[model samples]
Target chain A: MLDKALSGSSRYWTWVIALMAIIGIGFVFWVQQMIEGLTITGLSRDVTWGLYIAQLTFFVGVAASAVMVVLPYYLHDYKEFGKLTILGEFLAIPAVIMCMAFVFVDMGQPIRIVNVFLHPSPTSPMFWDTVALFGYLVLNVVIAYVTFGAEKKGIAPPKWIKPIIILSIPWAVSIHTVTAFLYSGLPGRGFWLTAIMAPRFLASAFAGGPAILILLVLLVRKLTKFDPGLKPIFKLAEIVTYAMLVNVFFVLMEIFTVFYSQIPGHMDHFTFLYVGLDGNTTLVPWMWTSTILAAVALFLLLVPKLRRNEKVLPVACGSVIVSIWIDKGLGLMTGGFVPTPTHHVVSYVPTLPEIMITLMVYGVGALILTVLYKIAITEREIIEQVK
Target chain B: MAKSTRRGFLKLAGVAAVGMGAKPVYDAFARRSAPEQPTPPAEALTAKRWAMVVDTRKCLREHGCTDCITTCHLVHNVPDFGNPKDEVKWVWKEQFEHGFPEQHNEFMSDDLRHKDVLLLCNHCDNPPCVRVCPTQATWKREADGIVMMDMHRCIGCRYCMAACPYGSRSFNWRDPRTHIAKIDEGFPTRTRGVVEKCNFCAERLVRGEIPACVEACKAKALAFGDLEDPESEVRDLLSRHFNIRRKPGLGTQPEVYYIV
Candidate 1:
């Protein structure tokens, strides 16, 4: 089936080459980061995490979103998703790859990363996250490959694959929940300590991940003959709208609790994000932009007439992806550190090397995504022709 | 390759369940009672919960008095990067308003408002850092409550940094060796991408000496002793003065105490 991908037009080769070029540039910077240390990034002692972690958080959502398609198709026996389930699973392959890569890049001692497994502490959320991510990656890879292989052979998927598919639904929820647990369980960080963090992570993930899926399916329709159709796409749009609504509601609840209670420790972080905190307002503009974008996205998605319009659907989905990316990827961890542990306001901005390295990680994800997607589409084309 | 039978799956699950319970059951039998008096000549291991007392009056907010801080940094080979963003401090000075955040008040005495306080790792009994450490790279010593860091084992994820409420831990963003003008042979300089913090002078303690800071304080403001010993100076000092530990209400049970 991959042989079909090998014999692509110059256009496909060009895209692959472009991703490779970006990856090469990223590799050079990565080497520099490893040698010069994370200091090359804009990260400070006060804000220990910066660009790499944000990317990790964002991709984890993307990876977990695979279950949205898988659940409806396998559990509910929704035939519309049969053609598109492989797309979600394949997209997850690269997303999980990116998730793991971002984690590696963020490490202070990348070499000692194995210590998490070798000297495993069941108590640490990081350890559990390591488990959740790697496990999810393995599950997706197996399910996608086996199902596609069966499709390529023009046979029914093996009966045993059903259990693994069933397991992935809860596994998907666990991945995001565990990622949320990473932040929410921390004792003193004012911004991330709330109980709603895990639920909020899932809500945004359900919207953001599926939003990417809708966009990817559109890309697939244009790039290949495998059109998942307007029916499946419209159904996905509905999921995105409802999930984003819940996500927005959760954010409002957080705002009410933080502001109404007026706890200085908690209020100070929100102040830094929305208003300036002690004259340090680096993230103020970005926060407001996300808020506006989220509102516009919910407005566009909630209106059924606007949602059905092909032109408006992409716009709504793109807004959701951007909005959550800013919320989870950029502001979530960094905002929590404001009025630092000592109650001093400090700021962080990613440096050029950090941004380059971050882009390289995305390029790697794109490369993996393009290859995996090409194979899935090629298999779909061959299977349809035989039928 | 037979299909996995329900009986076989259940058997595997049963074994895994028993394996998980084995550790706790063994520990229950193996656990030792708290010693009334610390075992003497236990230099190779830790003590019965180390604690400290900071006498703020004797700490002396005098001009340019960094006897404790300077001694700690110099001995530990802690680098001074001169940039706050890249700064790596093992132990440092902070204002009362900043260090004791919950205790801040606008109508407080002018002197207290301007007061300088020494801050370092609390060595909490229920350390959030330890609980959050993915690799157990940082842990509380079972013998003493001193939070220990296995620098070689640390992945530098900095989750522990986020978990700590005191801003105590510092990460080595660059090769820490780059910032040091001179080397201290007694202490091993840390590599880049590892978190470092005050260890209650765990190294010096093993040598049967007090913390470098306590010994170097000209004002004799620092006190270090075993909390388990009723006659120890730290315990005696705590009994004599009404001292406050940072974020006591968090229930971390910090071992460090300060007297105003």
Candidate 2:
């Protein structure tokens, strides 16, 4: 059984080698980031947090969304997702790891990150964020371990594990909700201060996260003989559609409040993103593209015919993922800074060194994910041999 | 000779003289225990909350008050960036319209074009920055009601920078000492990547000295005192004249009030 699982064409090795090369280039870039400090990034006083944080914020949601399928399938005994639930759990391990990696790279003193625990600041949202992140990481690992352990034993999971699984559903929601509070609770930043921000964050996470999972499932089918079936994928996509609708609705509410009230503080940020405030048009194209893509993707997902087609489904999911990434990751940070409180135009452009560092962090996350999944797959093969 | 010395001492010591000489010292020592006795009621102890009232109208547009900003920043080891791109300021002066955009009067003249206002952490009664700080790095002192930042605990997240309406907070982007040739002999420069802001010269306040900025103000335009004390200089000044605060409607109730 182990030999059969290991028997793959040379193409798999080629792909692995190629990924390693890309990762190597990214490492060189990270070295430059360390030497130059954050000045190498496009971030400035106005836009204090940029792509790194935005990606960090978005990915936390993606990691938490894994429970959307896991809870209903496992605790509820929905056998439709029995074969695919492990894949979702495995996917969460990487996403959560990546979320943490992105945050570490964004820190000025990555070495002193342990100070967060050594000298905890109870008032800081960041402290809470750290607590939530580490908690979710532990929960994911434990859940995966217990489930995989039961699989190896060829028996139902222990009764105690059931309570733990049930508890994780809301724990999953809390991780993303706390992440949203990190932004929305900020009082002065008009773009992020809405009460609806947390709900919107969960919605987008549910939409983008499940979409990525569906795409990954499709890739697995094309590459290997494993077929998890389309039933679970369609069911997950249906959930994704509703989440996307809610996400878009909250965004529209944000727009309406800003425009209708015409409060200069709130309007200024929107104008900067949409209408090019004070001749700073850098973010205009990106914002508009995200808005259009999100609309199109939502429409496609809502249509039964389009969503049912495997070909169209993947494209729609990819589009929504990219759209939300741009909107939440880049647009949110850039827009927050325009017409700065001092009314100064401080532009941020990600320097080459900054981009390289970002790429390096991405490569590191990918590396961790690759190794973990490989170990899990290898373990399964060993178990099959024993059987 | 002994009899003469005794006679001299007797002449030197008079009962009335001794009593006069020791009276004040005895009184002072007796009063020393007075503070130990709890006599004041709750109402008397509740002095008015400390606040500031700045007269923006009296501002002469001269940069003399920059001494206040410089002294405060120097003492706090604030990084001085000749380049605006890397500029990090715990305190600075802003032009009039920038500081009070809504205070446009029809009679305002061009000569006041560059009229500047000293800007620092408002130390608001209801500070949003304090509310948003995840780590409680920024906190309000119940004693004097000054909002302060604890640099060591700051995670360099800069959420306070985003949450401040006054744009008073600054982020240390690089090593603060990198730009300076010699560290000021006394004050240590900050580490890179943490948020720094006007602590209202809290260290100086602790030492029974006024904030450096207030001390350096040549025009004596900036004043610092307990607003709770009605007879205190700041309270007296506020009662005597009309003063304004930056973004009053934001409901932050800034301690750094200004008059225009």
Candidate 3:
């Protein structure tokens, strides 16, 4: 099964090489960051966290979203998803890896990372996050290996894997919940101190996660002979539609609660994000763009005609991914920091080297994803041809 | 039958016992003939819970005085990057509106409205920084309630910084050693990438000396004493004045109080 990734067409090799080049460039910048410290980044005392943390947050949702496919296929015995579940599991493997990479790069003392485990504080959400993420990653890897191997051999995945598959369902939810706890539990951070944070995270994850999966699935269809069929893709787009609707509703809920209650601590952050707080409006344009794109995505996904149209479906999925990307990856993390606890507004923008390092982590995720997908596609092609 | 002789014998015995007791006292006095005496060291300051009170009335009376800030930064070996972005501060001055934003009002007295207030780590009794620290690098000391930072253990995740409601913590964005104007050999300078802040002068308290900031304030605006002790100065001050802590509604129970 591993040998399949090694033997590929020139096009496959070109894609692999291109991701490798990105990984190489990113690695260099990461090393430079290690030497020079986070001073090279656009972070400050006020905005202590920035791009790395936001990416970690967004990718965690992507990793957890795999459960959407796994749950329907495994629990309901949905045969239409038989081909798509493996894609979901393979997608999770790199998403989790990207999450780990982002956490690694975000640390000021990356060398002392072992201290989290050595002297673990159960009180800390971050410690629980580490445990949850690592556990989810292991669960997906084992499930993918066993199930995919059984598929290649044309036998049932051993009886033992069923319980493990069921356990992953909740584990997926836990990873994102714990990640949300990392921010939401903080006392002074009014933006994240809402009961809806975990729900919002899951909703956005379900929307954004499957949106990316749809794009990857389309890419697989174009590059390989293994088609997952149209029914499963349409079903996933429907899931994206509802999840995105709920995600937007959660955002509106926050807005209503903050504005109605008229708490300066809570209202100030939303004001900073949507409009300008004081004179600083760096995130205003980004926030509005995310809002408009989300509206566009919801519009595309809601209409059955546009959604089923393959060409327009990809456009909708792209819109969902970008919309949620800006919402979670750009706005969410930085918004919490602005209108700093002191009531002074400070904005953050990622530096070039910081962006480079972030891209490097993404490149690593892409490389792992490409290789895993290549292997899965080749196996699916062989099985279809024999049938 | 021998009463006369027995009485004389009893009297002699009583005199001998009295002489025996008095002999050691006389000997002790004769041995320490010198006037000079060795003095024992002052006892290390101990408090069930340490707290500070900033008398804003006294603090603002003298304008443009950074005595406390200078002394604290110098004593702690805090670096000056000459810019706010990379600045590492232990004790610093913050404006009244910014320091106590919750307390700020539109129609406040002008004297109290725009005055500069001294600010440092609140060392909250329910410190969120301690609770959120993944590595247990920052913790509220069980003995004195001072939030302690173990720089070596901090992975520089900055979760503590984010969790701190008062904005008390500062991260070493660069090598702090590079920017220190003069290094204090007594206090260890922090390396780049670890979150650090005011330690409430735990080191000074061990040597039976007060915090440098409190000592440096010429106006005597800063009061440091045990919050738990009813007899302590801070406790007495809190009882007298209408005081406030930054973001007290958050329930962090900040030990630092402002005497409004």
Worst 10 residues of 3 chain A by lDDT: A378-387
Q: How much TM-score does chain B earn in each model?
A: 0.83, 0.76, 0.83
Best-to-worst order by DockQ is 1, 3, 2
In candidate 3, what are the lDDT values of residues A122-185, reduced to their tens digit? Answer: 9999999999999999999999999999988999999999999999999999999999999999
Where in model 3 is the C-alpha error above 4 Å? B1-42
TM-score of each: 0.93, 0.86, 0.93
lDDT of 3 by residue, B143-258 (tens): 99999999988899999989988888999998988888999999999888999999999999988999999999999999999998999999999999989889888999999999
lDDT of each: 0.88, 0.75, 0.90
Could you give the fnat of all candidates in order? 0.86, 0.43, 0.86
Put down candidate 1 lDDT per residue, B98-172, tens digits, no spaces.
999889899988787778888999999999999999988898988888999989789999999989999999999
Q: Cα lDDT for residue B17, model 2?
A: 56
Better-scoring candidate (TM-score), 1 or 2: 1
Cα lDDT tens digits, model 2, A150-245, are 886788777787778777788888888888887777655677778888888888999988988899888877765566689898998898899899
- Which candidate, 2 or 3, has the higher TM-score? 3
Angstrom error of the Cα, residue B174, model 1: value is 0.8
Native interface contacts retained, candidate 3: 0.86
- Evaluated at residue B145, the lDDT of candidate 3 is 93
